[model samples]
Every structure is written in structure tokens, then in C-alpha cells.
Target: MSGGLIGLSGLIILFVLLIIRIPVAFAMFAVGFAGIWVLRDLNSAMSLLASESFTIASSAELVVVPLFILMGNVASVTGMSARLYDAAYAIVGQIRGGLALATVLGCAGFAALSGSSVASALTMGKVSMDQMNRFDYDNRLSTGVVAAGGTLGILIPPSTGFVIYAILTQQSIGRLFLAGILPGLLLLSMFMLTVVLLCWLMPGFGPRGPKSTMREKGRKMAGALPVLLVVILTIGGIYGGLFSPVEASAVGAGLVILIGVLEGRLGFARFWEAAKSSIVTSATVMLILISAHLINPFLALTHIPTLIGEYLSALDVAPMVVLGLILLTYLVLGCFLEGFAMLVLTMPIFFPVITQLGMDPIWFGVLVVLTLEMGLISPPVGVNVFVVKSVATDVPLGRIFAGVMPFWIAMLVTLAILVAFPQIALILPNTMIE
Candidate 1:
């Protein structure tokens, strides 16, 4: 068999492994190592595996992953996320569908620090679900909004999704991060609008929440101010060229830890728990990245990316048409694969086609990350939906999925808008300070 076909078979086997409930990192690692051994030699495979693991583990820029994760964990444990949610609820809870809007806003706020849909969903779900239920909101909308809103974590800055895309594509992490901001805010706005439309069409989906006086609202807002400042400073510092992405992540994580500790919100036990969670999450990401490095080289040895890119290049269709198809593939894959797995597996093939088509890597990265966000709430394997379900145990899985449908459509709309006007993502990246 040709090396390409052998590579193809290895990929199929990898998916089969994944289907059998093997961990993604292990599945990729096993397939990639075996592919190298078969296509090259055992010595070459061993060398690549060892070198790649060390490279991934030792890379300084990758420190952003653990630091950002630490930020999220600290925020979750210290009640910073709860305060953010309470602030949004105070500001928006009184209007029809206001609680849902607050949920989206809260999710957005937490996304800035957390950079994780699961964390965002878990934190926001715990904070907002009971309040929505108390307001007699529909279970579907309440859970759905949390699931959908949590997806903002991947679209916003400090996003692990953006970080992964940057590392895979060799794009600038800061520029990729900048690229996500406008698009993220746009998606956040669209989600809020979706809630408005739903409430207008069916008032029962999200009932009006109790009103908050200005004094009460001020208190909630005041409570969130410290953490909010951390978001502003970390993101702004990145934007203004004051800090590298890794440095920004460190500053953000440090600020959260300091703020939490000083306020007695993160006591010794909680602090240790947050740090442990961050380490575990970071280790998992490092493993996935290392496996990706191994698999990418094996695929290179097979010339599969070249084979596919050449075929796509010879096509007569406009590049945008091809881009649309690539995104459509992502949308379909969203129902099955986790975002990181899809990114690490497909970027070697698709990103080459992208550059060959004369597309901006930063623009494509934003688009790809946005597509990953959609997967977080897509059914059957909507990771964020399931995360929400874990916290909202009384809400049916089907109901959570149903609730997220409108927001999913909103994501589609946002993607379409960005595709039509690439500037939405590129403007900030293009104008970046450094």
C-alpha cells in the first residue's frame, strides 16, 4: 500500500480507538507512534516520541496553558465567577428573558478569565441555574443558555482553543488571541439577541426575574470589580504589547490568586485544590500537544497533507467556497469529536489547504476556533451541554440540547458574518501593537 493509504488506515484505526472509549491523547499517541514505526522505523519512532514529548513539555510559551487553567480554577474556587454572574444578574435580571441575558453576560465575563467552556458552564450553571428556576424560567432555556453561553470561553481571549490553533498553525498566539475578541463579543451579543427573540416568541421560556434597586446592583457590580480589573489589565496588556501571551496568562493567574487569597475567598484547601486541578488539566493538554507533534510528522512522512492540499488546489472553486466546506466539515465533526482532538487531527491537512488558497492564517485560526466553540454545544457529544447537565442534574440532557439550538443557530449566523467580512477577526490582529 502507498504510504498515504497506510496513513489513512492509521487514521481510521485511531478513530476506531477513540470510538471504543480510549482517551484521545492515548489514541493519538498510539496511532502516531505505530504509524511512524510502520512507515519509517522503530528507532525513528522512538526518537520522535521522546523528542516531541520533551519539546512540548519544555516549551516556555506553552506555559500559558497551565497559567490560564490556573486562572480559571482559581476563579471558580474563589467565588470570583459567582460574583461576576451576580453582577450581570443584578444588571439584567428584571427584564423579560433578562436572567438568560445575564447568564450569557456572566458566561462572557467568566470566559475572559477561564478560557474553558467546561469551567465556564460549570461555574455559571451552579451560580445561575437555581435563580432561573426560582424565577419560573423554562428548564430548557435556563440550561440551554448556560450551555451555549459557556461556549464563549473558547471564543474569547486567553482561550485554550486559540492557543491550540496558534501552536498547530504556527500563528502568533497574541494575534490569534486578538483575533478572537471582536468575534467573541459579536457572538456574545448574538447569544443575548437570541434570548431576546426566544422570550419574545415564547415568554415562558425565560420569565422576568425580580428587579434589583440601583444600590443592590451597585453592590454586585462592586463585588465583581476586582476580578473585572484583572480581565481588563491582562487582555489590555496583551493588546498594547505590554506582555507576551504567557506573561499575560501569568499576570492574570497571579492576580486572581492574590485577590482570592487576600479576600479570604480562596483559603488553603481551596487554593491547593485549584492548583491541583490546573496541573492535571495542563498535563492533559501537554500530552495532547505532544501526540499531535508525533502524528503531524508521521502524516508528513506519508505526504498526506501535500496529497490533499494539491488535490484541493487543483479544484476550480473559489477559495471561499472551499473555506465554507472546511467549516461545514468542522460543524459536522462537532457532533462527535472534542474540539482539541479535531484541531490537532485536522489542522495539518486543512491548514495547508488554507494557506495554499492564500488565506490569512490568523483569520482562519479565528474561524476554526469559532467552529470549535460550536462543537462544545453540539448534540450527542456537546461537551459544554454535558458539563451543564452535570450541575443541573434535574434538567434532562435532551432539554439542554434543545435549549442550545437557538444559540447554535446564532453561532452559524456569526460565522457567516465573519466569513463574509474577514475584517471582523483581522482588524484587531492587523492593528496589534506588536
Candidate 2:
């Protein structure tokens, strides 16, 4: 048959494999290699496989993946994440839904350090769940806050999501990092407002927390000062042109380790565990990226992206309408696929359409990452919801999903605001970078 038909069949088989619970990287590798062999030759397929694997595994840009993950893992092992929560609690825990608000702030802070949504959800859930429970907070609100707030990890600086998008689209990672700041904070504020409205409407959902004395607040803030400083240094260093993204990652990791050791928190055994975990996570990301490389060439050979771009360009609608449709597609697919898998699968097909419309790639990257965050909380395959469930095992799965609905709506609102004013995602990157 035609190349397009072969590509179409391969995609269907890939989706079937995913639905049957095959691992994402493996499924993509299988489909991509087989499609290349069918369209070209076995030797070509083998050559592409070996070369792609090596290229992705040794990529210089990807150094950030392991280092940033190690920083987060070490921070968790050393109780730095807990101290961040304590500082946020000291500031806001006395207000109505205060603990939930603190959880959002803590997630934002930790996201700046970790850049992994699973790590953010897992760490914050462990640190905040019992505290919220102690205050008689509703299980739904407590679990929902952790699940939704954790998404900040991908929108803040040092985000793996932005890194991968940059690699695939050939955009500037530093610009994408800067582009995300305002939008991330906007989403954080929307989450906090959602908590306030929920508590106001349903007073039993989140009760007011006990007040902290000024001295206690000061002590807690002081305890978290190291983490705050690390965040400012790493992200600020990137914006100030003092360090490239790779250097920032290394610096951030070194600083976290130094703090952990000096504070007598991270012992050799714990440090070893964190390093090992970072290696495993980094390996997984590398594999996905390698598989994506195979898939991109296979799709290019089929001319599918060209066809889709032509079809989109022929449409009479405004570019914003097309953008809306594209985002809506992401929202639907997110219910079925993991965020990175979705990014790897769709970027090759959709990114060209974005550029053809004369839109800004950096702004689009921020919007795409934000959509991925929504998918982390969306049902059926809400990865963040499952992460929260693993922490709060006694709570029913449906309840956690239900709790995230309000925050999910809040995300939709934030997405809308960014769409209305593209400057929200562009202002920093525009003025700061060039």
C-alpha cells in the first residue's frame, strides 16, 4: 500500500499495544522499527535503532534530567521538602483552607526544585496528608490538593516536559523555562483561589488551621531558607545568563547535596538511594526519547505531518480556533495516555502546524506543558491522581478523581487566560533572553 497507509496502520497498532498495557517506550520502538523495515530494509531499521539509541543516551542537553532528579530525590531524603511545607504552613496555615493553600505553595516551591510531577505529588502527599488530616480537613479536599498541586512540577523552571519539548522542536530551553514562570504562578494562584471558594461554599471541606506565633513562623522560614536560596540561584542563574541550562542543573544538584550533608540529613546510604533512583528515572526518559526519534523519522517518511499541515493551512478558520481545536485534542488524548508519551507522539505531527500559522513556539510549549499538567489530573489515566492514591491508600479512587475536578476546572481557566493574552507566557522570555 501507500506510505501514509502503512504509517496509519502502525499508529493503530501502537495505540492497541498501549491499550493492552504495553510499556510506552517498548511499543513505540516496536512500531517504529517494524515500520522502517517494512518501508525500507532490515539493515536500515537496525542502523537507525543503534544510532538513535546512542545519540539520545549521550545527549548533552539531557544531562539536566539525571541531575535535577537527583537534586529532588536528595532533597526528599534529607527532609528539605518537609521544611518547605513547614515554611508555607507557617505563612498561611491559619486561614480557612489554609493547609490546602500551603500545599499549593509548597508544591510550587518543590516544583522549582524537582521538575517532576510524580516527585512533587509523592513528596507533598507524604508531607501534607497527615497534617491536613490532623486538622480535620476533608479527605477529598486534601487528596485533591496534593493531586492537582503536584502538576506545577512540569510548568516551573527545570521542567523535564519543557526540556523534551525543546529537544523535539529545536526551541530554546532557556526561553521555554522563562516563558513558564508567569503562567505557572498564575495556575498556582488559581489553585489557591479554588481552595478558598471550595471552603467558602462547603465549610466542612477544609477547616481553618491553628495559628502560628511570629517566632515560630520566623524559625520555620529560616529552616526553609536553603531550599529557597537554591531555587533562586538555579533559575535565576539561567535567566541572568550566568549559567546554561546544563550548568544550572549541575549547580542545583551540588547545592542540594551540600546542604543535605551540612545539615546532617543525607547520609551515605540515603544519598546512594537517591542517586540510584535518579539513574533509573533518567534511563527511562532516555529510552522514551530514543524511541521518539525513531518514530519521527518513520512519520516523516510517510509524509503524514506534511499532509496534516496542508489540510490545516487550507482551512478557512482563524488561527486561534485551530489552536483551540488542537488543545482540545490534547485534553482528550490525555485521558488515555501519559504526558510524555503524548508529547512524543503528537509533537511531530502538530508542531509544524503550529509554526506554519506564524505562532510562537516558546508560547506553544508553555501551553502544551500546561495541558500535560491537566492530563496528570484527568480521569481514567490521571497519573497524578494515581500517585496521590498510592499515598492515601484508604481513600477510594473515585473520591480522589472527584476532588480534582474543581482544580481541573481551575486549570482550564488558567489555560484560557494564557490563550487570551499570549504575553503571559512570552513576557519573560522576550525581555530576559534577547
Candidate 3:
């Protein structure tokens, strides 16, 4: 059989494995290893597997994964996330649909710290859901807000999605991180506007919340200062050349831990638990990345990327048209695949085509990550929706999906805006990073 045929078969089997509920790491590993063995030799496959695993395991750049995760975990355990939510609430909770707006803001804030959609959704859901419910907010609006807001985790700085995309495409992590800033804030604003519109159209969807006194708002903001400062220092440090991404991760984690200790919010036992959770999450990411490395080589050996690139290049359509088609493909796949899996599985095939068209990889990275966020709320495999459902068990799964639809449309608008004006993603990376 031809190499293409073998690669095609491997992908089919990999999809089958995923459909049957095999873990993503194992599925990719199995398909990649088998494909290599068929095209080359068992020894080659084995050596590649061993070397890739070790390389990914020992990667210095990836150290940010665990450290950043630890910062988020520690923040969650030590009540920093709660305080951040309180601050947002004090500032906006009095307006109509303000609590929902605050949830989105909180999710954005936590996204900066955690950089995981699931973590952002889970943490913000716990922190904001009850508060929204107490204000008699519609479950659909409340659940939808959390689910959609959590997706900001992947688009904001320190995003694992960007890290994986950068590693796969050989782009700069700092540049990708910088590229995400404006777009992330844009999406956050879009979500807030969606909330305002929803409440305007349906007055009962989210009632007006009680206003906070200026002193109360000031006090709440004061309480949230530590988290806000950590967010600023770590992300600002990266943009200002004060620290590399790795060093920023370490600094953020250390600051959060120190603050927790000083406030008597995190004892040794709680810190240990947070660390353990971070290790587990980091391990999962590392495995996916290693498996992705294996799969990239396997696909390369099959010449699949070359073939796809040729096919795309031969098209009579404009580059932007081709780009739109590729993004549409991501949106369709997002319904079925986890964001990172989609990135690893498609980037090798798509990145070559994108570069061939002379498109900017950093901008493409931001667009891809943003599409992945939409998937988090898309039905069937909407991971963030399920995450919100877990937090609000009394709310039916369907309602959460329904709630997220408008926000999903809002995301579509944000995606369109980004597409129309690529500068939203490229400006910071271009002007600030050099």
C-alpha cells in the first residue's frame, strides 16, 4: 500500500479509537507508532517514541504548564478566585445582567491565571453560579455565561493552546501570547455586550442587581489586588521583556503561593493538593504533546502535508477564501474533538498550506485558538458546557447548550472581526515584542 493509504488508514483507526472513548494520548500514540512501523521499521518507531517522549517530558519551555497550573490551583484553593469574582461583582453586579457580565469578567481574569478552559469554567462556575441564581438570573443565561467565558482561558496569555500551536508550528510562544491579548479582550467585550443585549430583549433573563456602595467596591477591589497584581506582573513581564514565559510562570506561581501563605489561606496540605493537581494536568498536556510529535513525523513521512498543501495551492480561490474554509473545518471538528487534539491533528497538515500562502502563523494561531473556544460551547462535545452542567446539576444539559448559543454567535462575530482586521491579533506581537 502507498504511504498515503497507510496514513489514511491510521487516521481512521485513530478516530475510531477516539470515538470508542480511548484516551487522546494513547490513541495518537498507537496510530502514530503503527503508521511509522508500517512505513519504516519497528526499531525506528520504538526509537522515535522513546526519544519524543523523553524530549517532551524534559522540555524547558513546557515547564510553564505546571507552574501556571499551580498558580491557578493555588488561587482557587486560597480564595483568590473568589475575591476576584467579588471585585467584579462589586463593580458590575448592580446593573441589569450585571452578575452574568461579572461572571464573564471573572472567567477572563481566571483564564489569565489558569490558562485551561476546563479549569476556568469549573472554578468560575463554582464561584459565580450560586450568586447568579440568588439574583434570580435565568439558568440558561447563567450557565451559558460560565461555559462561554471559560473558553477565554485558551485565548488569553499563558494559554496552553498557544504553547502547543507554537511548538507544532515553530512559532514564538511569547509572540503568540502577545498576539492573543487584544483578541482576548475583544472577545470578552463581545460577551459582555451579548449579556447586555439579552437582558435588554428579555428583561427577566437577568434582573437588575443591587448596587454596591463606593466604599464596598473599593474594599472588594482591594481584596482582589493580589490576584490582579500577579496577573499584571506575569503577563506584563513577558510583554515588557522583564521575564521569559518560563520565568514568568515561576514568578506567578511563587507570588500566588506566597500571598496564600501570608493570608493564612493556604496551609501546607492545601498547597500539596494544588501541586498534585497541577502535576496531573501538566502530565496530561505533556502526553498529548509527545503523541503529537509522533503523529507529525508519521504524517510527514506519508507526505500528507505536502499533498494537502499542493491541493490548497492549486485552488483558484483567494487565500482568504481558503483560510475561511480551513477555519470552517476547525469549527466542524471542534464539535467532535478536544481543542488540543484538533490542533495536533490538523496543524501539520494545515500549517504548511497556511505558510505556503504567505499568511501570518501568529495571526493564524490566534484565530485557531479562538475557534477552539467556540467549540468548547458547541454541542455534542461542548466540554465547557458539560463542565458548567456538572457545577449546576439542577440545570438540564440542554438548557446549558441553549444558553451558550447566543454567546457562541457572539464568538462568531468576534471571529469575523478578527478575520476582517488581522491587526487585532498581530499589533501587539509586532510592535511590542521586537
Candidate 4:
């Protein structure tokens, strides 16, 4: 069979497996192994699989993922999230829809340390939900904001998604991390604006409260300063080139533990729980990586990427049109599949089209991360919505989905801006890397 035909067959089998409810990693590995055997040979394919698994697992750069995850877990265990919310609420909790806005801001801060959207949503949900309910904030808006805001975890510095993208595209991890900063902040600003505007336009949806006393505000700020310092020292160290990404993660994890210990938050039992959780999460990610290893090589052996690259170049369509089609594909697939699975399934095919259009890899990485953020909040399979819904049993899935629509639109507009002016995503990396 022709290599291109083999590639097409493999893709069809993959989608079939997914639709049948097969585990994504397993489905990819199974199809990838069979495709490799047909396209190459059994022995060569096994050898390739074994080597790729080790190479990916032992990559020094990949250490950043586990360490960053550990930092997040440690902070959660040590009660950093409450301090963050206290500060956020003191600043924004008096206005109409203020509690909802505080939830967004607090989630963004917590997300910086906790790179998982589910974790940020759950943690901030515990901290802010009651206060929002007390403040008469609409349930749909209150829950939706945290769920949507938590997605900033994947776009901010130290994001696992960015790390995976950097590895897949062979882009500089540091540059990808740098590239996400503005977009992340831009998204945060837009979300806050949405909250304010929504409250202004429909005052019945949100009611204002008396402002916090000066003493209360001062105490909240004081308690939150430690978290700010930790974030500044760790992220600043990386962007400043004082430490590599891996080293920055280590330092961040260590500092979280150090703070926990000094504050008496790191008891023996708590430390063990934190360590075990981190191990479990890290192991889960590694297993997925190992499974994806089998698939990536098989795709290469089938000459799929090159064939698609050639086909895309042959098309007379404008590059921007092709890019729109790819983005639309992500939006459609996102409604049913998790972001990681989506990345594994599509990267082999769409990445070729992207490179064929001569887009900057770093910019493209940010754009992809933003798309995944959308997937986390969109309905049916929206992971963050599920997480929030799990905690708030009264909030129907439909309302949570309804509430996220504005943020989704905001994300689309932000994407359009980045697409029109690549500099939004690329300028920092270009100037800073030199």
C-alpha cells in the first residue's frame, strides 16, 4: 500500500476507536503499532517504540512538568489559595458581580501555581463559592467564572500544555513560556471586563455590597504577599535566565514546601498526601506520554506528515483560510475529547499543515493552547465545567455551559487578534531571547 494510503487508514481507525469509547492513549498506541508494522516492519517498529519511550521519559527538559505539578500540589496543601482569595475579594468584592470577578482573579493567581484547570477550579471553588453565594452573585456566573478562569492554568508560565507543545514542535520551551505571558494577562483582563459589563447591563444579576474595612484589606494584602513573592521569584528567575525551566520548577517546589513547613502546614501526614498525589498525577501524565511515543513514530514511518505537508502546499487556498479550518477542527473535536487526547490525535496531521503555511511555531503553540482552554469550558466534554459541576451539585450542566459562552467569545476575539498580529505572541520571545 502507498504510505499516504496507510496513513489515511490509520487515521480512520483512530477516530473509529475514539468514537467507540476506547481509551485515547490505548487507541493511539494500537493503531500506531499496526500502522508501523504495515508501513515498516514489526521488529523495526518495536525497536523504535522502545527507544522513543526512553528518550521522551528521560528528557531533562520534561522534568519541568512534574516539578510544576508538585509546586501546585504543595501550595494547595499549604493553604495558599485562601490567602489569594482573601486579597482578591478585599480588592474587588464590594462592586456588583464583584465576588464573581474576585473568583476569576483568584483563580488566575492560583492557576499560576497550580497548572491544572481542574485543580484551580476545585481549590478556588472551595474558597470563593460560599462568599459569592452570600453576596447574592448569580450562581451561573459565579461558578462559570472560576471554571473558565481556571483554564488560564494552561496558558500561563510553567504550563504543562506549553511544555508538551514545545516538545512536539521542537520549539524553545523558554520562548513558548515567554510567549504566553501577554496572552494570558490579556485573557484575564477581558474576563474581568466581561464580569463588570454584565453586571452593569443587568444589575439584577449582581448586587453590590459594602466595602471591606481598611484593617481587613490590609490584613488580606499582608497574608497574600508570600504567594506573590514565591511566584515572582520563580517565574522571574526563569524569564530572567537566572535558571532553566527545570531549575525554576525545582526552586518553586522547594519554596512551597519551605513555606508549608515554617507555617506548620507541612505536617507529616499532609506531606505524604501531597507527595503521593503529585506522584499519581505525574505517573498518569508519563503513561500517556509513553503511549503517544508509539503513535508519533508510526506516523513518521507512514510518511504522513510529509505527505500532508505536500498536499497542503499544493492547495491554492490562502494560509489564513487553512488556519481557520484547523482552528474550527479543534473547536469541533474539543466538545467531545479532552485536550490532551485532542493534541495527540491531531498534531501529526495538522502540524504539517501549520508548518506548510510558514507560521511561527511559538505563536502557533500559544494559539493551540488557547484553543485547548476553550475546550476545557465548552459543553458536553468540558472538563473544567464537569469539575465545577461535581462540586456544585445544584448548578446544572446546562447553566454552567451557558455561563461560559461570553468567555468563549472573548477567547475567539483574542485569537483573532493574535492571528492578525503575530507579534502579540512572538514579540516577547524574539526580543527576550537575544
Candidate 2 lDDT, tens digit per residue, 1-434?
99999999999999999889898999999999999999999999999999988888888999999999999999999999999999999999999999999999999999999999999999999999999999999999999999999999999888999999999999999999999999999999999999999999999999999999999999999999999999999999999999999999999999999999999998999999999999989988998999999988998899887898889777999999989988999999999998999999999888989999999999999999999999999999999999999999999999999999999999999999999999999999999988
- Which clashing pairs does model 3 show? none
Q: Tell me the tens digit of each residue's lDDT in model 4 across 1-434.
A: 78778888888888888778887778888888888888778997798788878888899988988888888888888888889988988998888887888888888888788677777888888888788778777887888887888898998887889888877767788898899999998999889988888889889666886799999999999998988888899888988999988899999999988998998988988888888988887877776677777887777777777776677677898998888878898988888788888876678778877886888878888989999999999878888998888878898889889888888888888888888888988889999897
TM-score for each prediction? 0.98, 0.99, 0.99, 0.95
Quote the positional error of residue 118 for candidate 2 in Å.
Answer: 0.8
Off by over 4 Å in 1: none
TM-score-best of 2 and 4: 2
- Writing each residue's lDDT as its tens digit, candidate 1 over 1-434 gives 89989998998998898778788899999999999999989999999999988888888889999999999899999899989989998998899999899999999999999898888998899999998888889999999999999999988988999888888877889998888999999999999999999999998888888899999999999999999999999999999889899999989999999998899888899989999998888888888999999889989989988888888888899998899989999999988898999999999889989988889999988889889989999888899988898998888888888999999999999999999999999998887744
In terms of lDDT, the poorest run of 10 residues in model 4 is 284-293
lDDT tens digits by residue: candidate 3, 264-321:
9999999989989999999899989999999889999999888988998889999999
Ranking by TM-score: 2, 3, 1, 4
Q: What are the lDDT figures for the candidates, one per model? A: 0.91, 0.95, 0.93, 0.84
Clashes of each: 0, 0, 0, 0
Better of 1 and 2 by TM-score: 2
Poorest stretch of ten by lDDT in candidate 2: 305-314
User: What TM-score does prediction 3 earn?
Assistant: 0.99
How would the candidate models be sorted by lDDT, starting from the highest? 2, 3, 1, 4
Lowest lDDT 10-mer window, candidate 3? 162-171
